[model samples]
Target: MERTLSSELNTQQVSSKSAMPLRLLANLLQWQRRMASRHQLARLDSRLLADAGISEAQRFSELNKPFWR
Candidate 1:
C-alpha cells in the first residue's frame, strides 16, 4: 500500500492544528514560572541577594517587571 499526496497533506494539517493548543499551554506555563520567580526575587533579603551575586538594584529591576514581559 502507498499514501497519496492528498492524504499526506491532510495528515500534516491535522498535526499542525493539534500542536497549537500544546504550544499555547507551554507558553502559559513559561509565563507562570517567570511570575513566580519574580515574586521569589522580591522576597529575598539583602544577604540572600548578595549570596546569589544579585545586587539590590538588579533584583528591583527584575521584580518590578510586569509578568507579561
Candidate 2:
C-alpha cells in the first residue's frame, strides 16, 4: 500500500513538472500567432498606417525591433 502511495505521489510530481513546459509552449505558440498578425498589419500601406494613427517611421521602428521587446 505504501509503495502504491509513493508511486502515485511520484506520478503527480512528474505531471506537475511537465505542466510548466506545456504551458510555456502554449504561451510561445500564442505569441508566435500574435507576432504574425503584427507583421501582417505592419505590411499594410501608408494610408492604413495613417488611419491607425501609426506613422511610417513608427512602423519601421516596430518592424526592426526584436519580438521579445
Candidate 2 deviation (Cα RMSD): 3.6
Candidate closest to the true structure, highest lDDT: 1
Task: Please give each candidate's TM-score.
Answer: 0.87, 0.59
lDDT of each: 0.92, 0.83
Q: When superposed on Cα atoms, how far off is each prediction in RMSD?
A: 1.3, 3.6
Off by over 4 Å in 2: 1-16
Candidate 1 deviant stretches above 4 angstroms: none
Q: After superposition, how far is residue 39 of candidate 1 from its true place, in Å?
A: 0.4
Encode model 2's per-residue lDDT on 2-69: one tens digit a residue.
56888999999999999999999988987787689678877899888888898888888778766655
Superposed Cα deviation of residue 19, candidate 2 (Å): 2.6
Pairs that collide, model 1: none
